[model samples]
Target chain A: MTINSKIQNINCCDHIARRVGDIAPSGIRKFFDLLASMDGVISLGIGEPDYPTPYHIREAAISSIENGYTMYTPNSGIPELRQELSKHLKNTYNLDYADSQILITVGVSEAMDLAARALVNPGDEVLIPDPCYVSYSPCVVLAGGVPVMIPTCEEERFEISAEKIEPLITEKTKALLIGYPANPTGTIMPREKLEEIVKLANQHGLIIISDEIYSRLVYDCEHTCIATLPGAYENTVFLGGFSKAYAMTGWRIGYAVGPASIIAAMTKIHQYTIMSVPTMSQVAAVEALRNGETSAAEMVADYNRRRLVMVKGLCDIGLSCFKPQGAFYAFPSIKNTGMTSEDFAHNLLMEEKVAVVPGNAFGRCGEGYVRCCYATSLKELYEALERMERFLKKRGASQAATFQV
Target chain B: MLNKILRLLEDDGRLTPEQIATMLGTETSQVKELITQAEKDGLILKYKAVVNWDKIAEEQVWAIIEVRVTPQMKAGFDAIAERIYKFPEARTVMLVSGTYDLAIIVTARNMHEVASFVTHRLAPIEGVQGTTTHFLLKRYKEDGVVLDDKNKGMRQKVVL
Candidate 1:
């Protein structure tokens, strides 16, 4: 063998950090990277809201930085910010917590990481719904936990049953991770379902971690937190963030609310690991929670409008879809096109210059689905939707022709 | 009966087996049975519902792989080809009619994956010669359709 080949072999054979190396070999960023380089592409690939951070919230960040509020606050986060977050949770979801029970992390994204790390012991089993948020299972794996996925069908509006979840539970199962106003599917959990799940968690002694980052973006109905149900606040960790509601995705601010003990554990990790969230970000988030209500409401209203338009537009174009109740996403079934989610997405981007993330990227349950984020502008949505229509019709017509010949 | 049913479903695209059955003076169950038989016979390759792509978010990628084999080694080209085709990254492997003997299509997240497949997975096999890898730059036709702008909104809105 050549020296180069020898070096390559040596590197391949050497043991690396086990957890980092085992990360599932796919993610949302991969598609975004492709979308970035492609010319004339209109992307609904990444779940970023098109709206800017509201004026008042941006101003708060600016004011904080200008006033030299640049130093780290507390490891758990700024007291006022956490207090505001507590109030926001109680007011919105009827979930009560003090600042001591809330840990202000970078975002709900970070809250997920913290929850996974804090609760997942090596080889502990974590149950996640398939067609899930792309990050959940990987985070579980990163924490040395095994993820058992339950497929949530499109016909059921992608809701996971307590019954479906019950079968997957075992002695090794330590936690149940649920993301409502879910990422790709846009399926929001109804209160009854949330209550049932909370009951299951309680019955089985499973820690329930609820990622409610998209809670504020519900279109068809109000979001209900699992933590709001009786007996849940003690065991459930509620993840809320400023990204979706406040259009502050790039700002990277979120919080987790739970029992004092779990909050303390996460806070200890944050103290050593991240020190504190950015000072200006915490200030901005505080303003977002307290003073940015009108702005968030207005933006959410717009997303709801776009949500309906895209759902209607997609179904009009012959794609099978359920109206998303929450989140700025529409998960549609692509099983009819005789292509895998990956194939459909690749063809769409390549042929139409419209980018989407494939369903399978989320999990195996996403096999015949694709997640289209309607988080773009109205013009972009209409244009991309039209392009998808054209792609499908043309494919349909040609297939028909081939059969006839 | 099966041939007629397959022909109708394939040509019309939207004809349900029930409709075909009515036209052919047979029961829907019989029509369904014929379609199933056609699929078993490989005459009807796939049954797919039409879907609009923009409704969901899906990530996609495409790559090409090249393989070199030790021509007269103990394990010949056939063995090397089998090994290359076994990787999940290898989507479709064909003994192509070209200057290169084998053509492989792979899909993955980014260049690093394609590179690793080439370096760690493809190159190290004992009888392998050399391989060429290409990230798909563009696709003019995928699944036999040119993704053009005109076809958008072809389906009328049906209330669900």
Candidate 2:
């Protein structure tokens, strides 16, 4: 055979699949690329915890490795982990998910992909609230499903209510997808709102794809697991993880808890594509579920305190921040600055060495805002706020205006 | 609100009352008043740096002396622990459980100084039965702050 030096004479773009080619690259990526080459940036961009995994939980994984558990695990993950997760769900939300109905994947990212792929037929439509986590709409589109964006306004605290969603449902509507406490916004859907959405889904004969990655990060307010609501369990795919609460993002471990049929379908896809999550992560996750409540609570408490600081800091800088009920983000309004979210982010990074993700990275409705994650240390948060105030002072947004949380 | 203010100061004592007020979403006057009351009530003690002295030129030898004592009438180990902790060289003093009755940390300029204090000052105390002195070799962590900070700022600056 003749050896070929290059795969294509023209461009690699021609070889890309139509479905994959159509998905827009993340809006935050270009800014991140710029940030990578910069120095001394205090970032409030990433939706991740700054803390490391707790000592005991990490030790569990180490002990598992020492016990010679280096091989691939079962496709559905270790039975012990599944069982522990089942108990955890029941204990936390009073939802009954059997061990067989829990499907472990490589983080909730994979779990969402699996859910979309397993449930979506070509041309089906999935209703999603605008300004959600970036992956929500793309997951649907990549699965050959149409994403119908429902605009949720900032006036109503960017809430995902049923009235904003019911009008979007049509015959092809396959699911109602939501993530709360949402990334970039930190908006937690109230129990009543989730119930309304679940009820609307029931009426439309649609499934509910709920990404509850930040379920444990609620501040002062309690997290309402939609699946725990009456008659909502069978119709919802509940995605939870050890990332935010346990600070185990590097471990790449998450799972989906739902009805047996849906889980079986997701498992079928997971088995062929991933085979299994990392065995050590599975071991560590089991420990997280079984004995990590105190660590999770401590992390959430820390996040709550930082949440207060972030919101107050933003408001103090004259960028009115919407008080986030959950997660570690404060989505502050930048409309008064008369600068596009992208320009604000870029300028702030360039001028003051403070990196923040522009709100439009989530969706169109996020245009006049920017998400500031409060999972950083208080010292860094203070420094970031000071730099941001200096940046905004030059832009005339630093008015020291009165604001309420 | 008072506890929240105290918690913020507990994490970093260098924070001013104004900064503490901003962080906890409260008033500076209120925080100041509460902090004043706390200081008066002994809830807020001296604010100082948690220095890793080993990294400095003026490093001192630390010795943990476990004193096994007989409980005296009525006063028990409290009277003895009070007497030991009163020493200026004693860094920490606690009445412990198990084999030891009192555990005291003694910091001195040299090992000889530490040994001299353990024998001359500590063993001479009332009701002191025996002593076990263990000299500290190295300190990797102090007051919840890791000395090396090797893993500081290693997390990815941004992610989806």
- Most accurate candidate by TM-score: 2
The pairs that clash in candidate 2 are none
lDDT of 1 by residue, A166-223 (tens): 9999999999998988888888887887788889989999999989888888864677
Residue A298 in candidate 2, Cα distance off native in Å: 1.1
Cα lDDT tens digits, model 2, A139-219, are 999999999998987788889888888888889999988898888788988788888888888988999999999999897
For every prediction, compared with the true complex, DockQ reads 0.01, 0.62
- Cα lDDT, model 2, residue B26: 75
